[model samples]
Target: MKITSIIIALSFISACRGLNMTRLRPYDLTAELMFIFEDIDQNGIMTVFEFETVFDRYDSNVDGRVTRSVYTTYICKSDPVQYELSHYLFDEYDVDGDHFLDYHDYDNFYNKMDTSADGLVVKTEFVNYWVLLFQKYENSDIHPMSTLCR
Candidate 1:
């Protein structure tokens, strides 16, 4: 579930100075979160606050908590190519390595998709996820779901 590309990018940082690493791009919020996410390694260090009451704030279903089906449904309904993403998600989200996707599996998947340093997937991150869900889509002219994604 770690965006392998981004994780590898983190590993390549040559700078280890205190708060002044070469990876620190002054205009790059994404890099900063990557640093914290790498440090936590469990997604705990970057989590910013407590918002358990805000259902679908992260978990869109308002089902009290996020589950795999809810998230996958979101992805499927939004991905530019729905069919392809269904299989892609199945491959990535089966966290037990058992090939069965579930809530626990999705916990890891959802966290990885939360690209922001804020620890929560606000609308913007959802859009980012869609764009990333199919990197090839970036070249297409599809209009992203602005109201939904962000």
Candidate 2:
């Protein structure tokens, strides 16, 4: 009985390892955002300057705007898993449907994140907003790890 149990457990473990299971948890989003934000001052708050720094990286042309192509390239280079989320965020941020993200769009996003109407965005506020935004994806049968978006 002992030997049989051991063999069964080993088989189960091996089978589990073969599966591509990637769940998008809140912490996963939080960690990704924190890493991207790069709180240089070690403060828990995200300022517009920090956001601008991130924007500048994607805006390779220094045109003060980020195009979808540039954003996709940047995100894919950093983390392929972020591809879907990046596109969703880009579309939502592009308030004017201009196919580009500019200062105006970013400002609108910042305001959305700063739920308390404060000039700054705390980690909780940022994470909460993203988690809520991702609710639709979470509810769908489509896995976040999959390339397809529902």
Query: On a 0 to 1 TM-score scale, where does candidate 2 land against the true structure?
Result: 0.71
lDDT of 1 by residue, 1-150 (tens): 569977876755522211222222232354344334333334433232322221233367444444545545665565423422343445666667664544566566658757664556554454455445455332333232212221
Could you estimate the TM-score for every candidate?
0.36, 0.71
- Models, CA RMSD each: 15.8, 6.9
Task: Compute the lDDT of residue 44 as modeled in candidate 2.
Answer: 86
**How far out, in Å, is residue 80 in model 1?**
11
Clashing residue pairs in candidate 2 (N, C-alpha, C atoms within 3 angstroms): none
Error of 1 at 82 (Å): 1.3
Per-residue lDDT of model 2, residues 1-150, tens digit only: 999999999988765433222445564565556645565565888888877777777888999988877787787677666555666667778999998999888888889989999799887787777777766454333223324322
* Per-residue lDDT value at 134 in model 2: 68
